[model samples]
Target: MSADGGGHLKMYILIRESVPTGFAVLAAAHASLAAYLKFRDAPEVAEWLSGPFYKAVCKVTDEEFEKAKAFEDHVVLTESALGGQEVAIAFKPRREWPKAFRFYRLYRS
Candidate 1:
């Protein structure tokens, strides 16, 4: 819960820069769905799912992706097209945005 009584949960999707735009979109989608399903039963996740369910997609370097993979709350997405390389990482809903991930920028057209 937030000060204004709104849910503070938000999902963060990070796509590896090496991946092409099309593949990146697919990878992020897969990671997001997987994370949502994996945590759907939690109270905070349930509240987030029932309403706005905010999500943000950002670009990350290979090194950053590796670092994010070690987080317990994240899901790493890989595919044959990526030659077994991780294409994206999605984080479970968090009350506050992570400071360590501040360097990444939002996905843009």
Candidate 2:
């Protein structure tokens, strides 16, 4: 689903641009699971699971990654391979998000 598209509930996993591709892949997966586990009881998460369950894996700069932390409905993931640096964030599934979320580019090799 498009980030700005309406209807289906969605989640976003934003990985730092500095992380290597392979590690970024792993970070996205870990971040997804972490967010799901951490917010499994939330109404949005439950509704999301019952519906379309959309997700996006986007790339962001380190500055954007830090800024994402200001949003409360997310889980930040740290990679031990990268000396425990915060590498990614997985946001809880919801119907609405901050406008900046729509501009993050989808991660590509």
Candidate 3:
């Protein structure tokens, strides 16, 4: 649920801050689609597809990127153009998230 306990669902895409701006945007898009394919059958994904569908793209430090991997319902995206380096992570849509997620900085140029 949202902070207000609504029925909204959201997916989160976290890109490494070190990635270039253009690559970061592509990474977020790639990660979103990949994560959706991976979790397409999930009830949460279905519910999200039925709703307005919200997403947050955040810039993460290297440490935060590692920490994001601790979540189970996520897809790690490796950029072949970047020598196979991991560039982003996309979490499955959910009604709620860990409190720490609220602190991630939004991706901004």
TM-score of each: 0.85, 0.93, 0.93
Question: Please, what are the lDDT tens digits per residue for candidate 3 over residues 21-107?
Answer: 989989998999999999999999998999788998999999999998998799999999899999999999987787668789999
Cα lDDT for residue 35, candidate 1: 88
Clashing pairs in 1: none
Candidate 2: where is the Cα deviation over 4 Å? 1-3
List pairs with backbone clashes in candidate 3: 1-95
What Cα-based lDDT does every candidate model obtain? 0.78, 0.90, 0.90
Tens-place lDDT per residue, model 1, 1-109, is: 2312334677889998888999988888898998888877778788778768788798988788788777677777887876898788888887765566666778875
Residue 28, model 1: lDDT of 83
Q: Which one wins on TM-score?
A: 2
Each candidate's number of clashing pairs is 0, 0, 1
The per-prediction CA RMSD against the true structure, in angstroms, equals 3.4, 2.0, 1.7
Cα lDDT of model 1 overall? 0.78
